[model samples]
Target: MKSALYLFLLLLALQVQGQHGSKLNAQQQEQKSPHSPEDQSQAEGENSPHIKTAPSNYDFAFRFYKHVREEVGNSNIFFSPLSISTAFAMLSLGARSNTLDQLHKGLAFNLTELEEQEIHEGFQRVLQLVNDPHREVQLSMGNALFIDDRLKLLQKFLDDVTNFYYSEAISSNFQNSPEAIKEINNYIETKTHSKIAGLLKSLDPETVMVLVNYIFFKGYWEKPFNNLSTRDDDFFLDAKNSVKVKMMHQSKPFNIHRDEKISCWVVEIPYKGNAVALFVLPDEGTMKQVEDALLKETVSNWMHSFTKRKIHLDLPKFSISGSYDVKSLFEKMGVTDVFSDHADLSGMAENALLKVSKAIHKAMVDVSENGTEAAAATVMEAVPMSAEFPPPPFIRFNRPILMIIVDKVTQSILFIGKIVNPAAEED
Candidate 1:
């Protein structure tokens, strides 16, 4: 008997705050700072999964972003590449032969360099880092499997997913499609704290199983923007099209870098926890050049080249969401067998042939003056600073720009996208 497995990946990053920082320069801060991400990875040794998987994850992020950019054109772009990669990695547990090879290759993992066990362990470590209790950020990620009542999964596969991915399996009556859909959607909504709802519009009655993954993240600014300082400002979409947005203002010493190669200004904003947001504003008409140069090495160089400097910053408050049917995109990346009948997911169950029928990913992010409502109540600590020697440079993000949210501990990019129109919730 042949049965179809549906994969649904939902990611929500709500109430993500913009930059806030003390007045101290970068050099003075460097003396008090801990090891860099690269140093920490090296200290953790080569056996660490965090060290082994970061490059693969980053490569996958860039590849996915390029594809999504091409597909969405000039619309507001946002997505959690980590979320999609995690789901696909989980699915690879049940895959075999070419399907498994394709999954690993699509994820930018080299089988010769990293064994499958090491890759899975790397993801496990990344998940642990993301949910670390010591961090001030609130992040929770989990996976679930909804199995039809009639199907029996392999005990080894079940145990592996539970042990490595921390996934939960629940039996569902898929013969009743509406009930199954409601159950899945409700679970996702609860997991994301109502940030996501009704994720499943419809489900096939023939589906034997559904694999789900969801992530919710909320982080506070170390120095939050004052609500009184935000005002309506113009956000230029182009030379002629402009929209009014509530632009947040701040004048503080921040890590800033100018990339002449791409003709862009890069600003790094720190969160209260182990995360930072990078904003890249391109020269007047050099967005295409910047976009084309979004390689991992370019980002690494920008991070290393930053110098602490005072700047008059003006950034808009925006909320954006994106939903993608990435099955075709995955096929475009050479992961085709899983969605077709050629899929050999025999490792998942006995006496059954399984193939993925659908792959859907949806993500939403909200950037505001003080992050999430829960984080808004916390008071920011006051820090003393030396006087500026020179008048600070003024930087305004009035035009379209690129944004990336990264976790410092694992050096993983949590979310990456661009905002062309702040007013539009969806494009």
Candidate 2:
């Protein structure tokens, strides 16, 4: 019931947040763009089960996120207690369809009562709003959920939250590094459509080394699947059930790894920035059955002891691209109390009092035998991740806020970051 309520609120938020679910722009609707029952994009085949509310799939994704968050040292110092408690509340309230409205009320209450210095400074204490441990942690979780199909909406949310804290907390130190400033600026525009503008001072570009980390995966398949032999095959859902799916097939030499303890295979595909998709297909015959039987113990044993072999490989030549507001996404994962102001945030900055502003994420994955292409980017620092103030004092950030990231070793940023902050930045 709670899950259903969350889904409803999600749909409602989409509508209220300007997602018309139509290609027709707002201005176009005013002019009354022609509407036809059939659409050109629909000239394709049936819509498959891609975005269904599957618990296992969702859990897997979030687990991957949690693991990454924990991997980023002192993860506990990221959010203040207030934010932690608020996150808890959000999780509980998410079960209710009217949760979004309630969250607004709760956030307003916190903003009025709490106080913070840097919002998230140096990542230290858990005493006040500005430096609260849990609050910043919740905010930093945004580190992952930044990719989104709707980059504009994602930018708006990003801008709102960053401005919330940095409005007064942030300081300027351009002498840190000029090349760093240029690097950061270039990356911001490239990643976020030029909406984000300033994230560093020329003086301290090396600061990036302090707060940044990266992951690059690349791979090549030993056996390539042939397009000619590829056909729609019956993929068993359960030993007793099955569904017909387009499965690519080919006979070639592949370093196929298998494990008897946990039946599966290791297939890899490399991409531009050393990114790769390592697929593990189970031999349980039925996908649903295999998934149901999956456990960490089995997975570990498979990864540790799987034997390599040469055999014919069958796969699906397909792509799945998706994006979501991860802030709300994690709310469903049971961390609700952190968004509140009545909480603590003394760890990140000089003062205490802070909350998450947004959490945006996007991903695209394509697979085949000869090779595969896949990319995943997530940013959840905020969804509705902003600290509300009465009309916000002086919007010194008249110019677009920028974010850039580069691998000094590679002289390139495989990924860039951004936050729109305001509608004005859209220009």
Question: Model 2: runs farther than 4 Å from truth?
Answer: 1-189, 192-247, 255-277, 282-289, 292-296, 332-334, 350-352, 369-427
Candidate 1: tens digits of C-alpha lDDT, residues 120-211: 89888877767655445677888999999888999989988987899999999999999999999999999899988888898866798999
What shift in Å separates residue 99 of candidate 2 from its native position after superposition? 21
Q: How big is the RMSD of model 1?
A: 4.9
Cα lDDT of model 1 overall?
A: 0.84
TM-score of each: 0.90, 0.35
**Cα lDDT for residue 316, candidate 1:** 90
Instruction: Indicate the TM-score of model 1.
Output: 0.90
The per-prediction tally of clashing pairs is 0, 101
| lDDT of model 1 at position 47 | 73
In model 1, state the lDDT of residue 49.
89
**Model 1 spans with C-alpha error above 4 angstroms:** 18-43, 371-389
